[model samples]
Target: MKRFLAFVKKEFFHILRDRRTLLILFGMPLAMVLLFGFALTNEIKNAKIAVLDLDHGPHSRQITDRLLSSGYFQLIQNLNASRDIEPAFRRGKVKLVVVFPPNFSQDFARNDTEAQVQLLADASEQNTAISLTNYATNIIQNYKSEQAPPGTVAPMQIDVQPRMVFNPELRGAFVFVPGVMAMVLLLVSALMTSVTIAREKEMGTMEVLMVSPLSQLQILFGKVLPYLLLSFINGCVIIALGVFLLGIPLNGSLLLLLAETLLFTFLSLSLGLLISTIADTQLVAMFASLLVLLMPTIFLSGFIFPIESMPRFLQFVSNIIPAKYFIEIVKGIMIKGIGLDLLWKPTLLLLGMSAFLMAVSLRNLKPRLNQ
Candidate 1:
């Protein structure tokens, strides 16, 4: 019993001395709990909205005030013309737009059927669109009931015509396809590259490669290029399956989508190379890939949960996640059919992240190559 206790004590001390082991054992649970606790939720809040109150009457103003004050939405734009609606959605500025037609208050007071409100929603994310329409409808209903004269049946009706844009049917596949593409491409590219390089280092063959005529950049590229080609092929296959089998539309330019996919795959590979520089073993590299890449892609990338619904700090943290930008780019192209004119921001961000990651990886790899 004493010898067994001593062995247990020694193992505990060994774990304490190994920082990576300690982090995996203690830090990961805490991080996962905090992230999942805040990030995973169905409720939506502070959703961006636009208002086109053509009526510009008291009731129109009142409903608009109620919506903003209800704490469920934030007004990002007050559109001036009907033509502005498409530009608002294409810019990703607002998720829902509340448009009160001309003479809205007068028609409602007269109990005319023309007292209608149109809700234009971006249904690329199905659940959010439904939730926003529901909330807006409820608010309008409450206003109608309260405005009715006492001891009388409700005399006014405000028809809410919720028109879902981009995806009128609100299919779940529209949302998940982009998310799955991001997650799969990132995992295949980063995990494979990290593991391959870690294996070479573990087997001592990396030393042999370092001594070869190939330069450090060439050595690293040679090790990773095959995986890059494989990842790109895998991305293309995923897109083909999504379009043909799942019935997800490829509405945007195929050439542009392919180009963006290649960029994202390269970014993921750069991240993997960066991970390999930090992890000396295959197990560590794999763990780092999952810990650093997979979880963030799933949670922080706004893949499953709406980022606006998460806590403020987590939303800020999500800005740094490459998958967040890539997923947006994919959805924008495939669902909204928007071109690079509107997508330049996310595309530039992906390029910047790729460049940064590659620079750091090359810097870290230089000393190892020399040794």
Candidate 2:
């Protein structure tokens, strides 16, 4: 017990002594959560569009007014002909181009309407285009319904109700906040440890420690244990940021959140140890960590993009990325309020991955010394 206490004390000293690592371990998670929560989102807003109102009547004007008032599309240009829309879109000045047909209001008033408006959207902006198209369709459909004569459509209608599932708000931030935590923590902690270890080699302290009487496990723990604590604290920092700074709710069990957080911390540290084992230089370790860990964790982890919708090969590849499992665990706990009973599969995968990384790292680690 005394020796264990001494070991833990040394571990704390190792972490607190390094100002750079301390700042990153505590600061990066908070920074990333805020950035993702505030700056980045799946929902596109205030999208700019150009209009070619050819009808030149109440119908076209009403359509323009609807698009302008919907808040999804912003009308930036008003052109007289449909031909000008091509150049505007070609020059990338607008995301959508609306063309209202001729005599649309006259046709409507005569009850001989066969009017249609063309919505030409930039397919390059796929997600934004889809959202705008959907909004336009819904608005047009509502307008058509309103155009129906009184009593032609039911005065009042009874409808079956549909309520939201786990996330009623559909805020998207609820999903991203937890995911960004997993991603940023993995990047910051894993890169920090790997690069720090490689730097020790560059500076020759690794040799000095090797020559000492410290066991390999002690030396390993002396490095990673501190990062583990820092990572755990960083988890707390992110939770606080999400709850207070971002106003993201923690709807599930705190104990579950902590348990999953510690698991994720170990998972990332294990990957860091593996990276340190493979690379002798800090630069290589950093590049490898960023390329291998940071990008995939954000892109492939079902954090922002749905894994099921990805290509089959990508779905297979994402399964091996430990960040995926951790993100699922944290998101499940924080956003979905899911308990361990429902999350055992991902939890086991993370634990297994950590165990595998430890074995591989220890095996790669020179019991005597690195040449």
Candidate 3:
């Protein structure tokens, strides 16, 4: 009994001394709790919307004000013309557009006529579009009810016409296909590259490469190029399956889509190379890829959950996630059919990230190779 107690005490000390063990035991659980608690909710808030009031009357303005004050929606644009609506959605900030027809207040005041308000929703994100439209409809109905005079037999009726753009069917495939592509490409590329490099290091073959005629940069590129090509092919396969099998529309330029996929694959490979420099063993490389790459790609990329619904801190953390940008690019190209004009920002961000990661990986790798 005494020997067992001593052994247990020694084990406790060993656990206390190992920071990685401590993180796995305590930090991982805490992170899981926080991520699940904050990121798993279906509720959305401060969803961006546009209001187009042709009437410019008090009733239309009041409904718009009520919507803005409901805390569920933030008005990002007050559209001037009917033509501006599609452009508003393509820019991607406006999720729902509330268009009030001419004589909105006049119609509301008349007992016989129905007041019409059209809601144009960017349904690329089906769940969010549904939620925003529902919220707007309810708000408009509440306002209509309040405007009723006491003892009047009937109040003016509000007809909220909701039109879903890009994806009227609200197919689940539309949302998941882009997200799945991002997750699969990033995981496969980063995981395989890291494990391959780490295996070479662990097996002592990296030393042989260091002594070879090739430079460190050449060795790194040689290691990564095959995986980059393979992951790009994997991305293409996912896209094809989504289009042919799942019936997802490939609305944008296929060449541009392929180019962007290549960029994202290279980015993932660079991340893996960076991880390999830090991890001396294949096990550590695999674990690191799962931890740093997989979790954020799943949760924070607006893949499954709406990022706007998360806490401010988590939303801020999501900005740095590479998968978030890639998913946005895929959705833009595949669903919205928007080209480089609107997609330049996320594309540039991916490019910058790839360059930075590749530069750092090579810089860190060269010193290790020499040593």
Candidate 4:
């Protein structure tokens, strides 16, 4: 036992003495969180909207005020004719062009009179078009409801307006690209980290380390530190791609993103450590990591499917997966732009899992090679 204690001390020295590794340990987590946080959300604000108000009457002005007051839309143009809409849409300054057809008030003169507002939105941006359309519809409907019922109202009415948000103009691929990056990053980091220590053993390096005076805990730290850093770098790569190339939003607090990412990185590294202790070779390690971390995180993490829509069993099972929490934190910070108060639950869960993995790893480490 004394010898084991001495060994642990020696291993710690090797790691602590290496400044490069320690720097990476701290740097990687912060970088990855910021990158992934921005990459994983699609909610857009401050999108440009164009108006072609042919009515020039109280109704058109009222509709315009309502849209602006909602704080969801910004008007880009006021056109006297409907023909100007297509040209504006082509100019790309307008994602959605609103056309209040001539005599819009005439239709609204009766309490139930039918009015048609043309919302020419860029279908290219699916989510933006859809979101703006819904808001505009709701605003118009609310205005109509306030008026007395006109002579037998038209059974149906449609109001269309196109104002986009974020990547306004909902380019579908633009939506999930960030979340996909988070998934890929977690997989790359977790899988690589899981196999690394096992690879050292397969190459006979672990035997030499085990025979050294350094402690097992130190050895474990040294191994995990490298992959943790690497995983963080992978996360950074994902973030850069999502932000610069994909134009994803980074509206939330950068600090919160980093803190959450660090917790997740610690959890992933510890999980990799647990896998290393159990596996005999790098291939087995790789296979095991994929089976344990890859499959579960992907299917259960709400990356592709809505968590609420999932089966109750799946919903319950997701609580145990570290990736689940990471996904939530990523979406919450990046997409929702929410703060720590709302995110503490997932953050705490991740920390608890990391501690559990680290504890089990320590208990599992054998004091001697033969044991």
Q: Could you tell me the TM-score of candidate 2?
A: 0.58
Q: Write the per-residue lDDT of candidate 3 for residues 63-172, one digit (tens) a residue.
A: 98999998899988888999999998887988899999999999988989998999999889999999999999999998988888888745689899999999999999
lDDT by residue (172-193, candidate 4, tens digit) is 5554654565566566656776
Residue lDDT tens for model 2, 194-237: 99888888787998988789986788889888888998898889
| Top candidate (TM-score) | 1
Residue 34 shift from truth in candidate 4, angstroms: 36
Top candidate when judged by lDDT against the true structure: 1
C-alpha lDDT score of every prediction, in listed order:
0.91, 0.72, 0.90, 0.67
* Candidate with more favorable, higher lDDT: 1 or 2: 1
| After superposition, candidate 4 runs with Cα above 4 Å error | 1-111, 114-154, 158-168, 171-174, 367-370
What ranking emerges by TM-score with the best candidate at the front? 1, 3, 2, 4
State TM-scores per candidate.
Answer: 0.97, 0.58, 0.95, 0.57
CA displacement after TM-score superposition, residue 277 of candidate 1 (Å): 0.6
Error of 1 at 82 (Å): 1.1
